[model samples]
Target: MANPSRVFAAVLPAAGRGFAGNEKEQVLEVHTVNRQSPGDRVREVQVTGTAEVCFPADRVSVCVSLGNSKESVAEVLSSVSRRLEYILQTLRQHGVSDKDTVVRRYLHRAADLYHMDAEVVATFSDFEKMEQVCSVLLEKLDKSVCVGTPQFYHSAGCLSQLRRQVCVSAVENAQQKASEVSQLLGQSLGPPLVVREEETKEWRNEDGEFGSRGQGAALLSHLPHRPTITASSRVSVSFSLRDKSRKQL
Candidate 1:
């Protein structure tokens, strides 16, 4: 037989690597350990957490699309440009600063999606501003009538802060759950064997739907009231186990 000190090797496959697309990563890990000493250990577990923080959204976006069609494509574009300029200027006159007021989307489609001759868009920070701008455009600007949805957004700073707070809360929850499990198993809770993080920011309608009939720009004119913000998050923690068989049991 081999000596007690002889080393052993093992191999295991894992799911894969993570991407930066989301607030968290979806992955599986494989660990291979050699019990070098008498007291060495090997254990595996899976844990997950869902944590979230809700803060009043202070930002919004609006899009206004206008169009015109002359005999030639160039004439149509020129006229459309003129109309959009007026609308954008109207928005600016009403406290919609250059920074806050942006042209969101511009398209030269042979066929108008809204079935209008042409389209242009203006984005704003919130509903109050959007309402004011909307009023001015309807009252003063050309009312050819094909508008897209107005979007709502939050700054990176706000999202980052909320993400941190929610992640910490999730970690705390996972720890509590782990302690309970350890107690039930008649084992002392040990430090976290592994810590993994995940985050999510979801926006839902009042009815809990993923999206609404008029999302972003489309909702601007259709919505009776302004839209609101909705966000959520989740986290996971892993702990090592030493569930040795107790002779008593």
Candidate 2:
């Protein structure tokens, strides 16, 4: 019997050859190299793996708008300023720091009415304290002050950390999948050859399939019961493989 693990070279004619000079003018080409045995073939497997992580929202931003209309610009400014001061004082009394508050004042004349508006923004880590501040503004403060629903989002630092952790988990999942596939093929999983991250998607679990709140009005009524933020990471990984027969030998 002949050894199957042999490599041979063969010569063949090139395509589109015609007689140019004398008889039997042709072109010779070398092509079609194949391994005599299946064991000589190189193997690589590509797998895509995804991982998702969920965490509760850690910070909240409370937005409040106050406006006053008066006969004189000075009077409207004074009233709005006083109300804004009171709102700030109330926030401080509830443990909100100055660094966490933002205030903007605007004045304009509309149809002989001196209009003054103030927008106040504050961020809080404690939901109870935030709720307290909002309640006080709506109940104790004058009706001139308007409050908008607080928008909920995860902290930037928290999201950054989650992305890193989820990417690692996704790669691990890819490795596990590759190992399973290698086992099924009776091959040993070798070192990874390539790694590529596909994408990372993050959203609130309460949003359901609505995606972002800015997408449409259809998701306006759904409320998040869990205040949970979910993140998913996808990765494509290529890994080399070693034959089981070689390992056994």
**Among all candidates shown, the one with the greatest TM-score:** 2
Instruction: Give Cα distance to truth, residue 103, candidate 2, Å.
Output: 1.3
Q: Roughly what TM-score does model 2 have, to 2 decimal places?
A: 0.59
In the order shown, what is each candidate's alpha-carbon RMSD? 18.0, 8.3
- The C-alpha local distance difference test score for the whole of candidate 2 amounts to 0.83
Against the reference, the lDDT scores of all candidates come to 0.61, 0.83
lDDT per residue as tens, model 1, 139-238 = 7764564445555555677767766787788888888888778768776566677787776776634322223546564654445433344566566788
Give the Å error, residue 170, model 1.
2.5
- Candidate 1 residue spans exceeding 4 A from truth: 1-50, 55-59, 70-82, 97-118, 153-159, 172-249
lDDT of 2 by residue, 60-113 (tens): 888899898999978998888988999999999999999999999889898989
TM-scores of all models? 0.44, 0.59
